[model samples]
Target: MGRNVLVVSTVDHADDTLRARIGDDVDEVRVVVPVVQQGFMDWLANDERAATHAEEEAARLEEELPAVSDARKGEADVLLAIQDALATFDADEIVVALRPDDETQFAERIAQEDLRPSVAGVPVRAVVIHEQG
Candidate 1:
């Protein structure tokens, strides 16, 4: 049976790297893009019409993500979102895509922390894809 891989990316294009890493064992690749909701308080205080507009904008942002199977909002923290997605999908593997020059401290956290396996209730291999320039 093919494995289900959950790819959480901050980049615009990560499919090529992901495909190469997973090889032929992947049956399905679920993509998640974590977004931070700015001006959330203002939106909450706005009128019905403005609130509706905010909702539409949020939906649009979700649509903009590449191969987005799920968009994690409210929680901009990628690690937390990955944990949530893992529980929701029960994925066999987790891949996190980031830029080479960008330092998000996620790589260090993932390496030192045992959160992934604890949340998955099994050994979950976490792959980090640093985008090549």
Candidate 2:
């Protein structure tokens, strides 16, 4: 059997980009879009709206990348969501798609600290995609 790779990103990544990085050894690719809640008040007020948006976004991602399975993490920390996806999908590897210009300071920290050895336990690869003008 081929490897299962879990891709965690805030935005959609091109399949060619992922395929180039992961190579042809992958049997399954699952995408996880992490939901970053702004604040407690905002989350409380917009919980339903957030869920709806996440659902729609996941659906759109699936439509765009028909070969991959897409999922959303609602009202959770990105690191925890990665762990959840790892278990849920039985992933063999993790690829974090990062856009340097768009990531928050917190996101940078998480990418450095929590995303790799702490969360995944499996092999992890971070692919930085520079934002195009």
Among these predictions, the greatest lDDT belongs to: 2
Candidate 2 lDDT trough over 10 residues, lowest sum: 104-113
How much does candidate 1 score in TM-score?
0.53
Error of 2 at 121 (Å): 2.5
Q: Counting only residues 3 or more apart in sequence or on different chains, how many pairs clash (N, Cα, C under 3 Å) in candidate 1?
A: 0
Off by over 4 Å in 1: 36-74, 101-133
Clashes of each: 0, 0
Error of 1 at 103 (Å): 6.0
Q: How high is each candidate's TM-score? A: 0.53, 0.67
Per-residue alpha-carbon lDDT of candidate 2 for residues 1-133, written as tens digits (9 for 90 to 100):
6788777665444445756776777677787766532335545465565556556665665555434765654333557767778767888888776556445434333433555554546777777766554
The lDDT, on a scale of 0 to 1, for candidate 1 is 0.51
lDDT scores of the candidates, listed in order: 0.51, 0.60
